[model samples]
Structures are given as structure tokens and as C-alpha cells.
Target: IQMLPMLVVVCLIPTVLSHAIPTGDKQQLQWISKTEALHTLETAVRNDKINCVVCSTIVQGIRQLIEEEQVEEEIDEFLNKACVTLDLAAPYICEALINEYAVEIYFVLERVIFTPDELCGIFVD
Candidate 1:
């Protein structure tokens, strides 16, 4: 009777409100930026609180920097050090770094900022 109509309205309210929620991709993209990504990675490394999902997102965003071949000295330095920071157990996050950096590994190497040892260390061991 009256209770049935109340239950129906409650169910409809949830359906209507669900559309207002942001999707995961939207939230993840909105939360990431280069400087923020770098900070998140740095903090995670320092704190030893590496979350695979967050690290993966940061690494994915970092790929954009590498792809455009951004040549600023600071950008170069960040990538060199950031690459060394991935010591977590998630192979995919490490793989994301490798796949993205593989494209410009030599370019990064030629800069003389990161040694071959450091670059290899990220993936090999």
C-alpha cells in the first residue's frame, strides 16, 4: 500500500542519483597532473607506501612527457630519478614504465643523467 510506493521512490532515487557520480576514469584523470604525479610517486617511494593502482596512473601520465620528447633539463632529471623509484611488487606498473621509457630509453640515456645500470635496474632487478 503506502509502504510500496515509498520503497519504489527510494529505488528510483538511487537510480536517478547514480548518474551524478563521476566515473572512475573521470576521477582518476581529474586527480592526476605531472607535478602531482611526480609528488605522489616521490612520496610513495619515500614512505614505502606504493599502491600499484596509483603508481600505474602516475606512470601512465609520465608517458606523455616522454612521448612528446620534452627536453627541459628539469623534465630530464625528473624522469631519470623517477624511473629508479619503482621498486614495488606490481609488474604491470613496472611494465608501464618500461614500455613507455623503452620508446625513448636511448634518448634518455644520451642525456648522461641516468647510467645504464640505473635504467636496467628498473626492470631487470
Candidate 2:
């Protein structure tokens, strides 16, 4: 039946929801939250599934977040309105920042935060 496809997708929703986030590596990217976005990269790298696929995304996200001003504005606004200070705020910001350029923002800010680049070199290293 033509309806079989839609029924299959519908049937899978609960299963998908049950394990919403795939544990190991996929092209999928996790969102960023914390004083700096590097924490996201750190977590991703530590995870068995995320470490490999994440390097390029981390570099790309960091570059994009800083080079693009509009994205920067959006993230700043998100931080303020979303109560980024709260622990619960992580998933919300993570959700909002999924495609946003946060790693780049963190990269750029590192210069401001650390006079000695080596201290923060762990990010790119």
C-alpha cells in the first residue's frame, strides 16, 4: 500500500524518540553551551562517536561564528534571552546553536581571553 511508507515513518517516531541522540559518530553535530564553545569540542572529542566527524565541523563552526557578524549577534542575544547561565540552558542553547557558528566565536574570543595562545592551543591542537 502507498500508505505503508508513511505508516513506517510514523511507527518509527517512538523508537527514534527513545534514542533521540545517536550515541556514537554520525555527521550529526551536538550543540554548544558553556562560558566558551570549546567545551563542546572537548566533549565531542571525548565521545567515541563524535571525535572523528567533529574536527572539521569544530573548525568550520569556529571560523563561521567569528567571521559572520550576524551569527555572532544572534548567539549573544540567545545567550541573554535563553538564560545561558542556567545548567538547563545548555540543551536550549545547544538546540539553538546546532547550526550556528559557535566554535568560531570561541576561537576568536580565545585571543581576547588569553594573551598567550599556547594556553588555549588545546582547542585547535
- lDDT for each candidate structure: 0.37, 0.34
Which has the greatest lDDT? 1
| Per-model TM-score versus the true fold | 0.34, 0.26
Q: Per-residue lDDT of 1-125 in model 1, one digit per residue for the tens?
A: 43322111111111121112111453473433344544554565567554444433433333344455554444534433334343332444433544454435435433545432343335322
Which candidate leads the pack in TM-score?
Answer: 1
Candidate 2, 70-123: lDDT as tens digits: 344454454333233222235554345423544444545445543223322443
Regions of candidate 2 where Cα sits further than 4 Å from its true position: 1-48, 71-73, 76-125
Task: For candidate 1, give the lDDT.
Answer: 0.37
Q: Which stretches of candidate 1 lie over 4 Å from their true place?
A: 1-35, 72-74, 80-125
- Count of backbone clashes, every candidate in sequence: 0, 5
Candidate 2 overall lDDT versus native:
0.34
Prediction 2 TM-score vs. true: 0.26
